[model samples]
Every structure is written in structure tokens, then in C-alpha cells.
Target: MDTALIVGYLASICSVTSFIPQVWKIFKTGDTAAISAKMYALTVTGFALWTAFGVMRVEWPIILTNAICFCLSGLILIKKITRRAR
Candidate 1:
């Protein structure tokens, strides 16, 4: 593959994996106290929009990357909201 494509893939991988630690920490500790709900809300919305844009443009990398991020951020957002509700 080309250098740009390789870099894109690496960036995607890094982006996707970046959320794992936060998710795992929340899972293990059940603490959403420090996570910003508004930020994650915007993040989830942004990722969702990006995924839709990717779908419209037929770009698998963008679609997959944003979709994964959407789900991950969505999970964190959900946890934050629900924990706050209780």
C-alpha cells in the first residue's frame, strides 16, 4: 500500500483503540464522574455525522472508523448519563 494509506490505517487503528482504556476503566470501576457528558455527546454526534458522510461518499475507512468511534463514545455517553440519572 501507499504511504498515505498506511498512515491513514495507522491513524484509524490508533483512534479506535484510544477509547479502550476509558471504557475498560469505566467497566472496572464504574466511575463516570470525570468524563464529560457534553463533550462525549458532541463526539458521538460528530462520529455519527462522519459515518453518515462516509456512507454517502462510499468510503469504507471513514465509515468503519467513525462507526466504531460512534459506538465506543456512545457507550461511554450512555454510561455517563445513566450513572448521573441514578
Candidate 2:
């Protein structure tokens, strides 16, 4: 395996896992007042664009990272929105 590819996977794993705590906190406390809707929207948009870039470039690392990132981020966004609504 390529060293860079290995590094990419490791980094992606770290970043993707980073969102778990936030998700848990949001779920446990049900307080999303501090979560910025604009930020989440812009971030998800950026992540989607980057995923597209990865597809065009045939870069698995970028694609994988963004996929996981997007999903986790999306979850957070939804949790925040729903939590606040309730």
C-alpha cells in the first residue's frame, strides 16, 4: 500500500470520528442553540463539492473522507435542527 494512501485513510478516520462526540452531546443534552445553521449548510455544501472533486480526480481518499464527513456532518445538522425544533 502507498504510504500516502495509508496516511490519507488514517487522517480521514480521525476526522470522521471527530464528529461522534458532538453528535452524542447533541443527543444527550438536546441543546442545539449554539449550533450554527449557516455554518452547517455551508460546510455540507463544501463537502459535497469536494466529494465531486474527488470523483473527477479519481481520488479515493478524498472521496472516502468526504463521504464519511458529509454523513456525520449531515447527521449533526439534522440533530441540531430537530433538537431545536422540539
State which candidate has the highest TM-score: 1
Per-candidate TM equals 0.91, 0.87
lDDT of each: 0.92, 0.85
Instruction: Identify the runs in model 1 with alpha carbons over 4 angstroms from their true place.
Output: none
Candidate 2 per-residue lDDT over residues 1-86, each given as its tens digit: 99999998898888888888887887788778888988998888888998899999998989988987888788878877777677
Please list the residue runs of candidate 2 whose C-alpha ends up more than 4 Å from where it truly belongs after superposition: none
lDDT of 2: 0.85
The C-alpha RMSD in Å for every predicted model, in order, reads 1.1, 1.4
Superposition error at 40 for model 2 (Å)? 0.8
Instruction: Specify the highest-lDDT model's number.
Output: 1
TM-score of candidate 1 against the unseen true structure = 0.91
Following a full C-alpha superposition, what root-mean-square deviation does model 2 have from the true structure?
1.4
1-86 in candidate 1: lDDT tens per residue?
78877776788899999988988899789999999999999999999999999899987778888999999999999999999999
